[model samples]
Target: MTRRDYYEILGISRSATPEEIKKTYRQLALKYHPDRNPGDKEAEAHFKEAAEAYEVLRDPNKKRIYDQYGHEGLHGAGFEGFNNFDDIFSSFSDIFGEMFGFSPGRRSGRRRPSKGADLRYDATITLEDAAAGTELDLDIPRTETCEGCTGTGAEPGSSPERCSACGGKGQVYRSQGFFTISTTCPQCRGTGQYISNPCTTCKGSGKIVREKRLKVKIPPGVDTGATMRLTGEGEAGELGGPPGDLYVLIQVRPHDTFVRQGDNLYVEIPISFVQAALGTTIKVPSLNGEVDLEIKPGTQPNQVYTIKDQGIKHLRGGGKGALTVGIRVQIPTKLTREQEQLLRSFAETVKDTVKGSGKQKRNFFKGF
Candidate 1:
């Protein structure tokens, strides 16, 4: 039988771009693939026909020759079409690799498989939440295989077909002067298959974007920039592949009353100068509650007091961290006349006591 026109076989115009040619062939191949349409002789013939058309149109030399002299020119170049399924698959092994993850071969048979993509989310928590573990419900938006189409990208009761252009390999090759170069088949877009009856939901993409709610348990002692991994909780996988993982990155907001370093909590407590001078028991704030902290007599400003077992909880262990309290003595900014008189009197006593001592370095201008 006389061969059909290459452009007509792929359903493309004479001015069709290379990409258009490839895309059209992919659609044809998928519709007539042997695997998809088993026991159908007509489908097999169509598969071979698409592959032949793709082989010629994909190569510049063959395409130019066929365009000038049609199939007669290819006969002169001694180009015989593929003889068997093995020959077709072998010629397009690299193309199949792009369509599937692996190349087609006798030992490595084709299988329906896919692997999900990982996802990340950022969460901000208060210091209290970090000290005590908390549970949260997060709504994660991601792409997953369509439930309606079951990731096939085809309408219900329908199926994807082998790419006719690339013969289900999803790629094409052309011989150069000395080297053979392989490229992605424009027809199938490198999927090695095509969906003629596309699923309306996913628009033939096989995946959908939706939000899913997941419960996340945040561990205690998780600080800023800490990462929590949730296995098998990421975006859903394609086809029958396993689901990916979800990563929750923690961002701890600064606290108004406390600063944390490792397992220690640092807080500054203000005390009146009188209290610092006379010693007193004051209330200190901790993660759990308030506790009594003792201020020694004549305590200086910026002195640190450590309270054991009162800070943040250990992330991985049993013991709690220490609470460090720094004393900030406040001098009276505005004093009453009586208070001023008392302070002046106290200063005089200090001066007199120093004068009474044997130290004789006092200058005469000191009294003035």
Candidate 2:
């Protein structure tokens, strides 16, 4: 029987890249795999067809010849389609591993140990702590190796025995028409070992959920959204596998008196109108502590003053940011009659001086 075009079979164009071709083949193979669609002859045939196309297109030399002379040319070069399921699986073990996460040939034995899942913990800190760095003890919840079974899941005096269903192998093979397919052994769950007497503590799971207290030191300049990774601090692995990592996500609490932008801090300090016009030294809040700031004469409302090295530390490099203080001039809401009269007299004198100069400043508080 004449075969379909390789590109057409894989549902790809002739100009498809190698990665695109492999991706297409992987999808098709996974969709029509016999293990997934048991007792379906049409799906098995599609799986074989995809495997054959992938086999030729994955090899550079075979692809070059097939591109030049087509399937007829591939036949002339001694290219034969897969003879059986084993042939197809053996030829595409790597691709199958990418699809099923393990080599297909190893299905007949114990599955390889896989790393445990990584975990995440959210950590909150004050803005001051973020600026100066702090040490904290965190209570983390995770899975740890069981003490009763020592990670084996078997009782103290009893050990796991070989699975009888798969004859100590991890997988069981079944004959379906012209194909022999292997699947994970249900009795042992692919471990090839069965616990006769389950561990009382972990109940044959090999892991226990417990809370662990860990001391963590947060470096200075760590901002919100920064992450710290602690290796080997996640869930315990299975079957002698390595433990995963723990990620701590930082969340900096909002400051009551300051706002941070990158490494800079902004603050608004209220000063009396008399102090603003006459200049004075006042204390302002900073991440470090209270610091004295000098207000120059003629300091206007909303005017800004900067204090160097008083803000948040740089997260990446050296030096710190500046603390910008915005001036807010306070206007007295209540005054005695005598005080009001005195202010009115002062305003009249200032108006006369401006009139004598024959000049007026724009928006110079004419009402005041």
Candidate 3:
């Protein structure tokens, strides 16, 4: 029987673009995957058909040949067979190998040592410490190189011996039709060497857990979520590999008087009703020290005042940001009889003189 068209199997048009072809194939493959549709013969057949379609359509040259001859011109093209389930598995292995830097066909006898794992630690600092920058001494517990046997994992004078199971070839070959695949040797565990006598301190492992102290200098203007990296400060590598790095994540403590926005500082200051009406000079807290700020007379509530060069320093080498002070007028919650009378008298004097006063006829008509 003649096979169906590759594009028809993937539910895509013949003129479909490369992206459309891949998207359709991926959707069909995921829907009919053997793992997702267990023991379903129809789904498995559809999955195989989708994979075969993608293999041809993904390549422009192969797609052209298939389009011209409809699988007849592609006959005896020396393409590997996929008649069995193992053949399908081998095809998947080749696709994944090309994508992730691992192939089942290529293997050397020797195994390369792997690097140590990276370490992460949280570092919390006060807002003051963040502004001024400070040095922090941290004690971190991690794996370090074993001193016994000098990290060789051998007992005193004894040494490791070559693995006899795989003939020191860390990998073993398995035959699959016309192809040979290499897999890590189970007996040697890909090390190609075995330790007859292990070190008592590390027990064949080249590292041990220990506490280490590190001094880190935090730069000024580093806010929360900033990370500082220390090279080669993580766990020691095994079998002479390179050590990993240490990451210090910064966490800034909340401040009572200041709210930071980028490099700028925002602060709310309370001023009396008299100070808001009749200008006054008030002391405001700055990063350096307290500074006198002039409150203009007749200042409205929630009016913002900017003091230049009084904020935190810019993190990216720019000049300092301005300190914005938002003034809030405080009204008396409770007043004595004498104070109430005085405020009443003052309110009556300026009642009709203001622009919004109902009695001011001229100001009201001026807008019209």
Model 1, residue 362: distance off in Å is: 8.4
The local distance difference test score of each candidate is 0.81, 0.87, 0.80
C-alpha lDDT of candidate 3 relative to the true structure = 0.80
lDDT of 1 at 90: 61
Relative to the true structure, candidate 2 reaches a TM of 0.71
TM-score of 1: 0.66
Candidate 1 lDDT at 129 equals: 96
Model 1: per-residue Cα lDDT over 1-368, one tens digit each:
97888788888988888888877877786677676687999989988888888888888898999889889999999888889875666676655434432233431333345568889999999999999989879999988779889888999899999889877766566655533455767887767787899999999888899998988999888899889899987877766588899999999999999999888999999999999999999999888889999999999999999999888888887998999999999998998989977876786777654433443345454577
lDDT of each residue in 222-334, candidate 3, tens digit only:
89999999999998886778888999999998899999877788999999999999999999998888999999999999999999988777777868888999999999999
Worst 10 residues of 1 by lDDT: 100-109
Residue clash pairs of candidate 3:
none
In Å, residue 70's CA in model 3 sits off its true spot by: 28
Model 2, range 189-308, lDDT digits (tens) per residue?
989899999999999998999999998899999999999999999999878799899999999999999999889999999999989999999999997789999999999999999999
**Model 3 alpha-carbon drift over 4 Å, by segment:** 1-106, 352-368
Name the candidate, 1 or 2, with the larger lDDT value.
Answer: 2
